[model samples]
Target chain A: MTTSPPLLPLQLSDVVFEAGGKRLIKDLNCRFEAGPPSVIIGPNGAGKSLFLKLCHGMLAPMQGQVTWNDPDAVSARLNQAMVFQRPVMLRRSVSANIHYPLKLRKVGKAERVRRTEEALALAGLGRLRDHPARVLSFGEQQKLAVARAWALKPQVLFLDEPTASLDPAATHAVEELIRAIHAQGAKIIMTTHDLSQAKRIADEILFLFRGRLLERAPAAQFFEQPQNDLAQAFVKGELLWWKLGKANRKRRD
Target chain B: MDDFGDAIRAALNLLVSLDADLMEIVGLSLYVSLVAIFFACLIGLPLGAAIALFKFPGRKLFAVILNALMGLPPVVVGLIVYLLLSRSGPFGVFGLLYTPTAMIIAQVILVTPIIAALTRQVIEDLWLEYRDQLLSLGANTTTALPTLLWDGRFSLITAVLAGFGRASAEVGAVMIVGGNIDHVTRVMTTAIALEVSKGDLALALGLGIILLSLSVSVNGAVYAIKDAAQRRHA
Candidate 1:
């Protein structure tokens, strides 16, 4: 994989995203600098995926900008890649799927072949090189999706619940790939609902709730001593509203 | 019953003997329709792909107009082309009237809409699935158009074949624009009309059988291509 210049310090300033007459993300101000993998954890409908898309420049914030230092969205996008929750496979062989983005970028034939082979081997999919991507098992397809993105050697990789549908074994494999990608100097920003997965891989944790950033802290500190009520309840595996209700009732009594 | 039997026998004899006149009509039919389809695809595929991929001010209106043109009466198209190519008309200086060129123009007018509209439909559906992934992979709409078109090729083949079927079967447009000129603009559909009018039922039946076979063969080829594409993907 060819090395790409680092695209870091993604800054979101007062970003607001609204759709269908509803505000999905509201006045979010955050800056993510170069670091280990940043895992976003929240309940379903908490806008974790939307936040990732907003930061990746796939969705424009209605009010503010998501700037990745120096380069604009289009130029920065060339050095960034995203893997959606449900990975989409092209109607072609796994090797061809890995080669597509490189071809689009006008990579030379020899370089494309070398990168494809290296990526396939990295993902442990060298044996399935000729297999049609759509025919692969769910786990294998997700792995191929990562391999396809990894071949690009993106500077910033955004993953939105990449293993949401995978079995535990598949999840472990995908997690390992994510770590490998991080080890190779790409900043990994991922979102997941799985608390344990976040605990396992997150260098820093960004906790979101109801489209708001409730807390952002180091993973160890956030897990050991969350600074917010919602984060505390979330860590205890208790429903936010239920915990709030009990606290209110005790205060009334 | 006797007429039917005699017509069948005549048709069989024409087929067995490889009648020169019959061969000429069939050949002209294939030539005109294939040329018409070729031009139609050249104009329509890109038009449809543009319509599917771009967001323009009047895109929906343009799509609706193309959809309505899909059912345009062939005679109406013939009349329009006939006027344009007539000596007093705007394009009369080209002197294409009463020629195979005019017939091809008429067929193109009739078939282009069908191909464009169906291509638009097929490509639009494909773009929906591919838009995000392609865009995420650093492709803009223009870069994505060719990929979408190529991936949706199997279904696009069916659309072009539909246009060919309409071109080959319709006689009203060609008869008017082509003047049914013997040995010049004469084709299967126009020849069938002339033979039936002259009470040459056997010759008409022979042309009819050939036309029917042509339609069936086109349909068969569409299914074969579709099946092959599906199997390769599967």
Candidate 2:
């Protein structure tokens, strides 16, 4: 197995966010080491997705900076890609949809075609390249979304509930695609309501509640013993966990 | 009444015979409407996209003006264009009044705001729908504005086609500005009106039929595009 080069992927300094006269994320700080995949597990409205957006540079931090780093220096990089829960497909064919960002970045014809094919292969979507992305089953579209991001060869990948709407078989397919992406050397940070998914895919987990980070720990430890009461309640299904554990327990046992 | 029927037959005969004057009128009307619609799109699309995305201090006022202009009476638009191009008006030094140029000006003014306001509405809906995703993508404000507009191209195409349909069918403004000069400025609508007023029913009816067919074709194309976009989006 190839190991990724050691590098710090992200650092979040005292970040604050206030919207609609309410504080969504209050004075939070975090640092993820260079090589391990991290998962953000939280209840709905807990700002897990929001924090991902902040890290991806989608939203301006009200108080602090989320910086990407390499051993040489800590600076922001443009080579990061993100996938939303509901994939936004262009009103175009599947091939054209995958070709969009590559076209934007001006990847040459031969290179684009090759990269796209490799991405499709990685996502197990080789046969559906010509199919209209919008017409694909939701699971297939989400896989295509991952394929689209993988084609970018991003340094860090942020997924905001990438499988929230999938069935079991489909969810497994997507999770596998994510693993494939991580194997290819992209550092992965994902937000999910599913603790089992976190346990399955995440090396580390960050737990959040009501727009705040309650705890961050290894995935095995987070599931085995969450540090905070809210995290405990969330894992046990007392909190509105968006049915994450319910699906996991039914499928796993 | 019988005379009117006879005139209709006569006009049909003239059309089948390829009457030069009737063909000239058709050509002139198409030329003018196409130019006006093109200019309307050039000005309207960007303005509409901008107004839909930005929130400046005077945004409400600008939106109100555009919305009000969408309903501005055709004759009022004609009168305004006429005054501006007339000998006594400010730009009268160019002496463009009662010309096809003046007619184009009138049509462009009459239709640009209608297209802009409608396009604005379409793009605004798209902005609301995609703003969060776009922001999450790290898109800046100016980039998001055009990106949202591009995402909603299906509806924007419809807006442009609507502008063309309106410009082609509108008569009050063009007639006043062009003076409907025979073989020169007389287009389908103005010619239809002139021929009818002169008891030349054949020419008027023939022009009306052609006008309806043209409108139908424009609308047909718009519908085809919408259907294709819908299928792909689905």
| Docking level of model 1 | medium
Clashing pairs in 2: A7-A34, B7-B202
Which residue pairs collide in model 1, if any?
none
Which stretches in model 2 have alpha-carbon errors above 4 Å? Answer: A1-9, A70-77, A106-113, A238-253, B1-18, B83-98, B135-147, B200-206
- For each model, chain A TM-score? 0.93, 0.88
* Model 1 lDDT per residue over B66-183, tens place: 9999999999999999999999999999999998899999999999999999999998999888877888887888888888887788889889988999999999999999999989
**Candidate 2's residue-wise lDDT over A1-253, tens digit each?**
8444444557889998889999999888998765678999887789987898888777779998776665332224346789998878766677776776676666899999989888888888889888878799899899998998888788788899999979999999999999888888888999998878888999998988777788998888888898666677688877554455455556666
Best by DockQ: 1
Q: How many clashes in candidate 1?
A: 0
> lDDT of all the models against the reference?
0.89, 0.81
Candidate 2, residue A238: CA error in Å? 4.6
What tens digits encode model 1's per-residue C-alpha lDDT throughout A87-173? 778878999999999999888999999999999988999999998788799999999999889999888899999999799999999
lDDT by residue for model 2 over B141-212, one digit each (tens)?
687666666677778888888788788988899888899998778888998888889987766776787788
Top-lDDT candidate index: 1
Q: Kindly provide the TM-score of model 1 when superposed on the true structure, using C-alpha atoms.
A: 0.92
